[model samples]
Each structure stands twice: as structure tokens, then as C-alpha cells.
Target: MKAVWLAVGLLVASAASAQDYAESDGAMLRFLDKLTSVTGDVTLSRGQAAQFGRLVVRLDSCRYPVGNPASDASAHLTILDDATQTDLFNGWMLASSPALSALDHPRYDVWVLSCILPEAATEAVEGE
Candidate 1:
């Protein structure tokens, strides 16, 4: 099952690479505490990191189709388990296809929801 998911993730990553995207200022992500059924969202700027419970989540980069928020959102993330100081996930995760590359934690679920595009992106769209 893990291998299959890895294969799917690679395919999705390759497909996404073919598109033109604009860098976003940050990303909006969500997490679920599987054991407690608690859910929450976090807004993280690129290069920012946040901690939830024993997990430390970092936003590396965020991007979307230029001027198209309704389109796909992709974010590069690095998540670590503070309890063990080991990485849980370190890759790009797609908002439209979260299952393609997901965190394999036993008690937590994290995924990208959308990107917080920069003001420059809005202006660029308006200029066009």
C-alpha cells in the first residue's frame, strides 16, 4: 500500500511540474487529531513553522496557477514529530489531491487547503 501511494505521488508530482505557477506568500492548512476528533486550521507563511501537540509543521513554499486561486494549490512542507525528532512528511502536497501524498501518522492528519497568494499576484492579474 505504501509503495502504491509513493508511485501515485510521484506521478502527481511530475504532472504538477509541467504547469506554470506563481509563488504564494503562504498556505492555509488543516489538521485533524484522529484520536480526539479535534480539527483546526492554520495559516502559515512560507518559511514559517508551527507546532501542534508534538508535531512541528513547516511551510517551505506555496504555489498556485498564476492568478487562479480556484485552481490547484501545491505546497512543499516538512513535518516533524517533536517527540522523536524524526520527519513524518517532507514533500509537496496537493490541495486537490491530498491522498496522493499524505502524512502517515497514526494519530494525526495534515493537509493543505489553499494558498494565500501575495498582493502582487492580485495586482498582476488585474494588470492583465
Candidate 2:
């Protein structure tokens, strides 16, 4: 019992210290339309919305690792289908693991690419 409790505690501590970065400006996302077999990328500033086919996607924010841009990225999104007037997805999508938390739309699939860093954040990091 004592050994099991120690292992659990270590796992929790490591998970808490895992890499997570938040961007303030905008996010870039790649979306695939499975029905049409077409794919494209879109950039959206925080709180801004863009339309892809009949689906409207809004980005709340995006995040990547502190220094590794190619590392795992995640974006908070809200997607709505105008034709049906229903929200299809409203949650975070991970770039490294798109299928983990994904939009369940038959026609469209959306995933994060990277978080666009604000000028201030960029400058600060580059200055170091």
C-alpha cells in the first residue's frame, strides 16, 4: 500500500509539471473536409471566427511548449454548422493527438497547428 501511494503521488506531481504554453494573440489551424476530400489551413486571432464550408470555427486561444514550436499544440475552439444552426464542437483539440479530443462532424475535421505569439512575447523570447 505504501509503495502504491508513493507511485501515485509521483505520477500526479509529474503530470502537474508537464509542458503547457499559452499564446495571447492568435492560432493557426488545419481543417480537413472529408466529404469533399479537401484540406486547408486558417489563421484566427483570439476570439475571432472563420468560416469553412457550412461550418463556422472560432478560436479562443492556442498554446505550445515554452520553446519548442513543433512540440504538441492545443487550441480551444467552438465550431457551429450554419445549415443546421447547431454547435458541432466546443473544446480543446491537440495537434499531437488530434483524435484524442476531436470534432465529431461527418463533413469536417479540425486540429491545431500552432499558436501565433504576440509581438511582445516573441520579442521577449528572442531577446533572451
Candidate 3:
């Protein structure tokens, strides 16, 4: 068991170390109401908060691969249930693998779609 865990840790360390990331100004997020089967999209800047259903979601930070913005996206989030006044989730969510770190809510499902790059990066991508 120890050996397996060590191997997994080494793999994760290597994968994380090899990537150079750029800080994004914001992210595009999607919210879904499981009961109603309704969904909506919203763009949120860092430190911005939005209300979806009864949940208040705040984006703390967003990041992506430096030169490959489409490759992957990750965002730090703080979510709270306004009605219950309880913290539902607070962690990093990955666009590539949202299930790995997801917001656990009974009626609402939220996930990151992509990162909103900086002006320079956005221009570069658009120009290409």
C-alpha cells in the first residue's frame, strides 16, 4: 500500500511540475438544477460572486496552461448555501475532470467550463 501511494504521489508531482500555468482573470461556469433540468452559464471574474438557485458561488482564482489555454482549466471556488447559511464546498475544480473535485449539492450541479484568459492571451488566441 505504501509503495502504491508513493508511486501515485510521484506521478502527480511530476505531472504538476511539468506544467507552466497562467493566471486567468475569470472563468465560465455552468449551473444546473437537477430537479428542473434547467441550466445556465455565467462568467465570473476573480473575487466575483454569483447566485445560482439558493447557492452563492464565488470565484477566488482561475488558471490554465500558459500557452495552451484550451488544454485544461482549474479554478478556486467558495460556495455557500444561502438558505442554510452553510458552506457547501470550497476547493479547486478542474474543467477536465470536474467529478474529481465537484460541488456536492442535492439540487444544483455546478462545474467550470473554461477559463477567461487575460487580454493579451485572448487577443493572441483570437488573432490566430
Candidate 4:
């Protein structure tokens, strides 16, 4: 009985959380060349990849709160180091507080800036 109740509670929580956010096709990210302190924006669609110096950054998806989509963004990213053939970072990064879940690298730093929705999605939101 206890297990059954726990499962029910988990489902309820997930459903509630889902209603608070919406998924997007792409995300805008900022990258810093630590050595030179050069910074720029990189926009990536879901499943698209971009190279920055020795790093390959890929965006899997992005999400933002429904009420204030531009205020905060979170994205699933997969970063690879080409020279080492290793994945340096593979997780979600938030725009509002990047240091909370930052990419640790000696020569490069990346963080989410905003989630980019498709034209249809943007229109739908505006229509509402």
C-alpha cells in the first residue's frame, strides 16, 4: 500500500511540473575562450552540433517556463573534447544561474542563454 501511494504521488508531481514548462527546438548559448576571454553566442537546434576551438558542443533540447519563456532557459547539452575524444560535459545547464551546473574546462566555458522556440510555437504562445 505504501509503494502504491508513493507511485501515485510521483506521477502527480511529474504532471504538475510538466505543466509549468515547455520544450523548444533549439537554444542560444554563450561560449567563452578562457585563454583569450573572447565570448560569442552559438545558436543550435536540437540534434545540431557546433565546434568551438577544441570543443564540440551539441544541443539535444531546451526548455523554459511557460509563463516567462525568455526569463530562464535550460538545455540538455553534450560537449566533447576533440583532441581527447572524451565527453567533457553532458548534462543540463540553466541560464539564470549557470555556475550552479557549469561546464568545467581549462580553456573553454559554455552556458545557456535562452531557449529558441519554433515559429509555430512562438505564434501559438502569442495567440494564447
Give the per-residue lDDT digits (tens) of candidate 2, residues 5-119: 9999999988865645656478889889998889999989999998889889999878767665556678899999989979899999888888999999778888888778767
For model 3, residues 1-128, the per-residue Cα lDDT tens digits are 99999999999999886577888889999999999999999999999999988989999999998777777999999999999979999999999999999988889999999999877877877887
Q: In model 3, what is the error at residue 117, expressed in angstroms?
A: 0.9
* Candidate 3 lDDT score at position 127: 83
What lDDT does each candidate get? 0.89, 0.83, 0.92, 0.90
Worst 10 residues of 3 by lDDT: 16-25
Candidate 3: Cα lDDT at 80 = 95
- Candidate 3, superposed: residue stretches over 4 Å from native: 1-19, 126-128
Off by over 4 Å in 2: 1-20, 118-128
Model 4, C-alpha of 22: deviation from truth (Å): 1.1
Per-candidate Cα RMSD to the true structure, in Å, reads 7.3, 3.3, 3.7, 2.9
> lDDT score, residue 118, model 4?
62
Q: Model 4, 1-128: lDDT tens per residue? A: 99999999999999998899989988999999999999989899999999998999999989988776667899999999989979999999999999999999989999999999767657866876
Off by over 4 Å in 4: 1-11, 119-128
Q: Backbone collision count in every prediction?
A: 0, 0, 0, 0
**Candidate 1 residue pairs in clash (backbone atoms < 3 Å):** none
What C-alpha lDDT, on a 0 to 100 scale, does residue 103 get in candidate 3?
89
